[model samples]
Target chain A: MKAATFLAALALGAVSLAAGAAVAADGPTLAAVKQRGHLMCGGDGTRPGISAPDAKGEWGGFDVDFCRVVAAAIFGDPTKVRFIALTTVQRFPSLQSGEIDVLSRSTTHNLTRDAALGFDFSPITMYAHTALMVHKDLGVKAGKELDGASVCVPPGTSIERNIADFWQQNNIKYKPVVIDNQKELNETYLAHRCDVIANFLPGLATIRAYQAAKPEDHVILPDVLLKEPLAITFRQGDAQWKDIVSWSVYATFEAEEKGLTSKNVDAALKSKDPEIQRLLGVTADLGEKLGLPKDFVYQIVKKVGNYEEIWEKNVGKDAPLKLDRGLNKLWRDGGVLYSPPFQ
Target chain B: MVEAEARRLVPRALSLDNETVRAVVLQVATAAAIVAALYLLGTNAAHNMARQGIVSGFGFLSQEAGYDVGESWIAHSARSTYARTLVVGLLNTLYVSAVAIVLATVLGVLVGIARVSPNWLLRKVSAGYVEIFRNTPLLLQIVFWYTVMRQLPPPRRALQPIEGVFLSNRGFTHPVPTWDPAHGWMLAAAAIGIGAAIAYRRAARRHHERTGRRWPVLWPTAALVVGLPALAWLAGGSPIGLDVPRMRAFNFQGGTTHSPELVALLIALVAYIGAFIGEIVRFGIQAVGSGQREAARALGLRDGHALRLVVLPQALRIIVPPLTSQYLNLVKDSSLAVWIGYPDFVSVTNTAINQTGQAVEGIFLMMLVYLSISLSISLFMNWYNRRIGYRR
Candidate 1:
């Protein structure tokens, strides 16, 4: 079990055996997080919409807000979070070392990561595909036209293998110039070191919309090289902590499906619907099951808003990336998002 | 005499007062402490990794490396094994290190001689070069050179200073002789010519010793080398072709292209190391006393002959030992190529670690490879140092 801390307790006779036992009862990671009075969330800090700092140095994005939802549920304060900037190579190691309580980074939910890396991913947060972006002057409309092209890829990402597999299947030959950082890869692509760039579709769209010198001059090829279902990841252990994180995110979808916006949530406290009353914490204490307050869902929605609100504010039509809610809509709305009943 | 003998002895051989016994006991304790510390660290790491569910060992080397290598001499693809990727990465490291070593040595020797030159302009320029390159950080210089390379004209607007060589941001390309079976015989002739020249030089030295007559070696050696290859060309009917590069859709197609990453890495390494090596060479030349120069002058040797025959051989003895360290440093510093997207050993190993999540095994291999490379360089330089020492 928690041998490291248990040995230290035996050494110092520290904090009373009762307090140590109490910590073990709840789970090590959450108790430690609570003792620190904040949650440490880390992610790729260079991507604009997924998780990066804005012009005022404030962190705002889908991933950053998702981290806030967890924070708000636990501490009842959306501000109880510190964001640690991580590179793709640094993400898993940072999580393994306890540098971050949760990886709100937009990482793919793949089997190897789940099993081999010892990570438990939350519900699929966003669905995207690895796509290629090239300058319009290249006159290439499809990925098949990318034969003999030099492609710039961020090193150590799944995008590298995805593009390679794509090329192999199509019988096309291409050169890969793997830059370690995404920001530098964009520069190299612009410098014509590469004729095309392979990245996550949302990431490529963010680049084309914000980082590009001329947004319209570059076109993202319509090809799904690989399906990337991004999610919130945490260390694999502590079933209670997993339920807390997973259900906290599920609350967002659950609220959106129930027509419970943050603006309308308070008025819906009196609604006749039994599930809505249970979800809003007016009837049942679902939050208490995960060791939060009776109204943790209400706290999360009030402080950070629901899934639709977070998406629309971060990467939607009015946002810089202006991405559509393509596959992220609710299940009844012809998309894949659905939440289990609050009961 | 009794007191001196008593000082060395003890009441008991096993006691700490016995000098040799004390020394042995202290060394044993220190060695034991080191071994224990290392064992603890190893076990602790293993425990923590196991608890975290992270796997260990080098078994991942045989798995297919799904990523493509940037530049590799060996055959590498997404389908190749991770072990093969390592060789490709190592070859890339060795290629850059080898080229940088030779070029830095040449540049350094020239600059060192110029620093002490009789002319005012040459001395000042060399001094300025040493100061500028040595004072700044090598990493900054690499990035500066990369940015400079990126600013060059695109492939379509490449600057051609010669008929066949093209220069662009993509990289420099020059016309190379196309492959032919006849060229293989020419290469073989060149190899034989080199062997013949070495024998002729030794024979000429023997003749000089016997007759006190200087046999012309340079002209004869050059004639044999060139004459053999020319004869082979004539016998093979003189087939020749040039693979010239021209503009294509995305990049130059025919001739070999040196990517900007390689060019930038070379310039940065050569310039930075050349400055340090220049100081070593300068101190080495100065270490040869004025007495040696005078002795050669007493024999009526001219200035060039005096410097070559007397001073250089002595200076080389001093230069080789320190030059060995610089060579080792240049090889290790090439790992910085990872930042600029050059697929050196560290760069590719980093990707492997990321993909496999086997940080321990990947890092151990990296340390092993670099350590081996440094040791080989050290050994070769030590051998040269021994050879250049004064003979009985």
Candidate 2:
């Protein structure tokens, strides 16, 4: 009876071991990420404002800043990041493979991408509308006027679907000339393979820069075809990672809402307001709860600066991108950037 | 017999006592170690994947693929399931591989023959062709082609003026012939004609073997192949119409267009593989002893006939195996389509893997597809090699 009991106990132990392994396999990716030292971030290599390399080969852009912000929050060093430059096709795979902790590329937050592509998107950062750009001599005023026009667009982009949907819904007939790369899309558009080029508004600015030598030749259509809510993305099934990323973005917004720039963050830390105190790590344990140091938010604001500062230094009017704040400004300033209360 | 054996004490042959027992024990222990290692690896991988919250199963394949594919053979929309998308990708891979193989073979053989041509210009040209194409990296070549193709003028100012064909940076737009319902009968008739031709050839060969007189096999086969098709066309009222491409202000309408990405990938694969095939062909011809060709010439055989009957038959033995490897290489290189966004099997599967988070299943499917393609080519080549092999 003793031997039989021992054998039964061994079998039970083996079964429990197997069950324990299975449970461990389902551990949250957020915890795994923290255990691993640096955050792996993926971004585009071409888009000027979103993510592109500077002359010294360091990445600097609006999306690139967010990556740094996340790194700053987690590791207390903004440079604690390994940037993986990816093409449109490679972005999602790089994220899914756990090759990158987050994808801050100019990816749109859509239903299909969120659910089908197995990615969770943070709140939208930049909301821009897709538009067409044409040569000035063409006299094309609006997308609706170019009903029978042929448009050049990059393949595997939402622009293609949007163009197709627009045509189908309106019973309008137009031809879509799809190319794979930005350079090819630009070339084909320049060579008159199509009447107009379709791309995101920011990308259109890049194209215009190329065509600027002959500036008298081109004009952007005064039509907004589709609204694209670009957001940072990460692999799904990691609620903690999602919260960390979500709140990191929210921290920037909250900082902006409190009129706390990097210069004023030190003074703001001594404020009496409960919300300000909680945000600046003076009277709350938000950072501790997130497995971060008590002064994590302070480091982010001081070192990385607030959302507006990052934007102006990278993609805003002062930067090389020279893009307008547009819908990226604070909610009080008539933009969509609003943060939930820190409390 | 047993009594005799006992009386005659023969030395025990190769006793399985000490050393043999040790050998068996060693082999068993090694196998057990290997099995244990494999078990550990499997367990560890399972544990790691579970810890990462990744499911290890083939169940995700049936889920809806909400992403759109740029190119597909079948009618696939975003609503189609992942399985169907993979099928489309697989078909595209096969399509490119099959077309590339045929083109490469023809070009390679011609250039291979040209390399050994007696004429100085032809030989130099062929050599230069092989060297230029072979030296350049395939990815660079693909990118170059894409760039150059994109620089072509738009459809409105397409360089080619042919009525039904338009060439531009976008791609070659051409009229695809639409077959009416009556065209099915014509296709059936053509198949019958081919069957008849085969029957006639067999009959002709048998007649020649018996009577020592040759029948007009070539003429009859040609008539069956061409004349039957023509007759079918007449009977079906020639139910084929060109759907000509029309130019609008922005793009072309009413015609089939091959995207620049596909064209670039196809060209790069063919160009790169064609060079290797050319070398294979050149070597195969050279492997046939020069003495054989000289002997044929001495026997009053012309250069063409000497090559066709004497050199080629011998050279084929050396040519086929490596040529099969070239075909396999072309199929594998089609994966580079991902770089240019051509949506081949690897590209689509990569996307599916990303979408579903089923890396193991996706990678397994990819490996299996490529493996099957390689195995099929090898099997066919092996059979062909066996049939043509020199027998002692």
List chain B TM-scores, each candidate.
0.92, 0.87
Q: Clashes per prediction? A: 0, 8
- The local distance difference test score of each candidate is 0.86, 0.78
Expressed as tens digits, the lDDT of each residue in A183-237 for candidate 1 is 8778888887788998888888878887888899899898889999999998886
Best model per lDDT: 1
* Top of the candidates by DockQ: 1
Where in model 1 is the C-alpha error above 4 Å?
A1-27, A269-272, B1-12, B199-231, B390-392
User: How would you encode candidate 2's per-residue C-alpha lDDT over B139-210 as one tens digit per residue?
Assistant: 899888877777777665787777777778668899987757656777787899999999998998799799
Estimate, for each residue in B1-392, the C-alpha lDDT of model 1 and write its tens digit.
99989875657657676666767766665565556555555665576666666777788899999989878897789999999998999999999999999999999999999888889999999999999999999889988898888788888888899987888878788888888887888999999999999999999889989996767888989988998998888898887789999788778888888888899999999999999999999998999999999989998888987987799999999899889999999999999898788889988988888788787788889999999999999988888888989888
- Among residues 3 or more apart in sequence or in different chains, the pairs in candidate 2 whose N, CA or C atoms overlap within 3 Å are A24-B51, A25-B50, A25-B51, A26-B50, A150-B250, A150-B251, A192-B154, A193-B154
Candidate 2 — which residues are off by over 4 angstroms? A1-38, A74-76, A110-121, A128-168, A171-200, A203-227, A235-243, A266-278, A282-286, A320-326, B1-72, B161-163, B176-186, B203-220, B231-243, B295-304
